[model samples]
Target chain A: MSRVPLTRKGFDAMRVSVIHTADDIVREHIVNKSVVMFDILRASSTISTALANGCQEVIPVVEVDEALAIASRLPEDTCILGGERSAVKLPGFHLGNSPLEYTPEVVAHKTVILTTTNGTKAIRRAAGEDGVVLIGSLLNYSAVAHKLFAAEQDILLACAGTRGKFSLEDTFAAGLVVAELVQLWYSRHNAAPEESCSPQADPVPIYAEEVPVLPENGLLLEDAAVAALRLAEAYRHKPLRALYDALHGQKLAQMGLSIDLNFCAQLNLYDVVPVYREGKITCL
Target chain B: MSRVPLTRKGFDAMRVSVIHTADDIVREHIVNKSVVMFDILRASSTISTALANGCQEVIPVVEVDEALAIASRLPEDTCILGGERSAVKLPGFHLGNSPLEYTPEVVAHKTVILTTTNGTKAIRRAAGEDGVVLIGSLLNYSAVAHKLFAAEQDILLACAGTRGKFSLEDTFAAGLVVAELVQLWYSRHNAAPEESCSPQADPVPIYAEEVPVLPENGLLLEDAAVAALRLAEAYRHKPLRALYDALHGQKLAQMGLSIDLNFCAQLNLYDVVPVYREGKITCL
Candidate 1:
């Protein structure tokens, strides 16, 4: 495929793709673009909330033992251990997989050594990627979207599905992000050209003609991204209600983790954009 | 997990799960429930259409060589070998992965030995299940839903995701099926209790109070199932538009297979329910 020059006028040609599970990550192909990873049930939301609460940084390890090993190497007073297995806190761990637990009082000024069943694995998969990797969820929705828009690169919304299978909450979070990005692109592209005198202005209104036309050889949405956008649109009117009624939400409720569901469902609750770089996630 | 007793009075407790990819199939667990396999961007649609057009039976083989070997063993004129690799037909195959090619004149009265990139692999994964296996798509949506409702057992909507990754089209198709089932269940469960004087009647109307109550410990929808239903609801207004704009659909169109997209996008075009039993998919 010939590389199309990125011109300021054609935001519609920017591609947005979604990877539904951590297991589906294609390292070679994915390394070429920026990625936003979502584990909305708790991991990503917790990380966002932790950073928003003034946590120094979060070290994500794939195994509980690895988190313990890393925590042992750090000063005990400056670091805190956090993670969960099967949605329950691991024995001897300081925290479980709940965003409510990562409050300002608990995580402030501390480096959180985190490991979870799915989120860390997804982060690890993108560890070798040359592009930027960011942790995202409903709590930090606009922050991540703004960062992604500024990056000016193709976006991949990677969903950290539960235990190698598709998770509704995570996929929904991805859809939410993708939908926001599409909307942002459209709003910018559809604005009256003379209003802002911006370089990214197209004098020709793309949809004004009798038969509206797509750009010639435009950047098309990958099917998964399209589906995610549709999903985001579907649940736009009471996102919290949808989250409460999700299958995982019910399971979490059954396990007495209703607080986590409530915490994860709060949209745009945090203004921090959690950047995962150099094996650690810290607020941008 | 304790097995919930099936009762006519409570439909909310019925289990409707979705397997997003073939890789997520747990043979031991999935074998216990009836499965509806969907490969909306084209396999399932083609199979359903073929059966609806009076094809004798559709045999799905996972391997291209297996399909060829099976075809060689059958009498020359009665059997036809069909499949595709990268959206194109094999050198000597009778058909490619286009639903339009499987019309009444081409596939009627003949047995189709079929293989494809993803659909057959999904079918083979569920072949060992001691339960009903059916081919489904938008073309025969109502038929498959009626059959599933009549079965009165747990339903697993298995999406034939592209090459072990979630394909937007397949997931959307699964969502469509689950949404229809949920709607069917609600309509039946919400009818006036006193009007019917039947054994299925509930003495107290479940939704009569200010706050509607779901049956106690009734049927539960898995998270993926709930997501699918929501997705189905999202695209209910313009499903064909969704299909034409699907990632895979765009790719198919790029490959000069717009005819298949048009054919697959048609809803309720066929009345036949294609049943896959003992290795053959035959019309009911």
Candidate 2:
């Protein structure tokens, strides 16, 4: 193929790209980037709840057999096999991927052997200690944003989309995370000094375009991230509406799981960021 | 992967998805779908300009050598070898992808054998007689959207991004097309009957979520398409700013091609839609 290389690689700004699904991720794009993976509907919400509720650790495996094998190695009483295949609790599993199911009494002091169709596989595939993998969802987006801001590396929001297609809820959650990061970045680095901001600095600009410019060392949101931020802005007044906008949410609502939707849509309810490093997810 | 299928497949409505870059397109998603391939930086814009300015026919080839070979077969005086590699005019080629250069005086009534880094290849690769492929850009998006609405098939906006990564201009143009299609849909299909519009129809709803539901037989913008639409909405007041916001546009500006940028960003200056079918691009 006769083509030029993407020139953005030489750019020095802190960049963010929202990979719509795990299937769409390019390894090179995320190889050295800090990742915040979102499976907003359930898996991520479940992980956050388990961690906040005192679970010792969450082992996100890619396959059910792997989870079962890992559980088999641990003492039966010390491990809880918890996950869903096609949104149903697998045979002999204690939980069905609902955040409510990971209550303190049920998950406390136990190791969660988890696998889901999308989220767990994404977690297993994208995990690398060098990338600072963090599990994100509405329940922990602000905490995730704080980590992303402090890390100051190229960022990727890997959305564990439903069944290898773009999932609205995951993208919406990603947009929320991006919005928070932008807010945090601006708060940490205030506008130019009043003297430099004076109109006399430059009577003329390069282009008379109204688009916001990324200041030096400021974050550069890619096109996908910018789109996601717009989405987040549109749903700022009612974040839960975003969850309900997805067909996955409608399916869950039809299956009498609106309770879980309500539970997962609460932003920053738990001040926890689950860091996935060296194969285990524990609170940051 | 243990997963349920994406439930939206069985949906009874018009659906749209925006594939961010040529490399990201899934063949299955576009198998029987009508596609508007956009390389908004230049290729599509150039094609629109050529067709609008009275070119006989435009044949898109994937390689410069293929173009040269094809031009060799045609009478030299009748065929115009046109295209660019890395935004530079190829050796012996007549054009370097700037819309302004394809004046009627130069290309009128001549066959254009064109190849470019992104858009032309996407056109050659995605063209099928049955899918109703069309070359689209900011230049002809409305006309393309008109064809899309009239065709009544699943729609795709395939962005021929800068290299293998997403291009901001292409996605923004896609968002504009989506907005147009939406406006046309709403204009053609007015609200439900006045009787059905009454408040007493149902005092309760399925979920208390504030989402604009897709009316029967209406368009279902997928998550990516939805994001694109949001982007279009963000720049609705200052459409041209979207072009300058892209790194590609900045590169072009640095190379003194802002004339092409301004030419491409005008929403619908050319009242032409170039249909790519049977390996040739001609007016619809």
Question: For model 1, how does the per-residue alpha-carbon lDDT over A74-180 read when each residue is reduced to its tens digit?
Answer: 99999989999889899999998788888889899999999988888888775554434788899887778877776666777888877776677787888777766
Q: Which ten residues in a row have the lowest lDDT in candidate 2 chain A?
A: A195-204
lDDT accuracy of residue B142 in candidate 2: 84
Clashing pairs in 1: B12-B219, B13-B218, B13-B219, B13-B220, B14-B219, B175-B228
What is the TM-score of each predicted model, taking all chains together?
0.81, 0.86
- In terms of TM-score, which candidate is strongest? 2
Question: At residue A229, what lDDT does model 1 achieve?
Answer: 69
Q: How close is candidate 2 to the true structure, as a TM-score?
A: 0.86
What lDDT is obtained when candidate 2 is compared to the true structure?
0.76
Instruction: Give model 1's DockQ, 2 decimals.
Output: 0.22
Writing each residue's lDDT as its tens digit, candidate 2 over B1-284 gives 11111122443567787887787666676775777899988999999999999999999898888998999999988988888877888988888788888999989999998898888878865553344478888877888888777777778888888777777788888888888878777677764423211111121133354333344676777767766776777666555667765767766765766677777878888889998877789998
- For model 2, how does the per-residue alpha-carbon lDDT over A1-284 read when each residue is reduced to its tens digit? 11111122443577888887887666676776778889998999999999999999999998888988998899999988898877888998988899899999999999999988778888865664334478999998888888777776788888888888778788888888888877776676674423211111121133343233334666776766766776787666566666666667767765777778878888889999998877899998
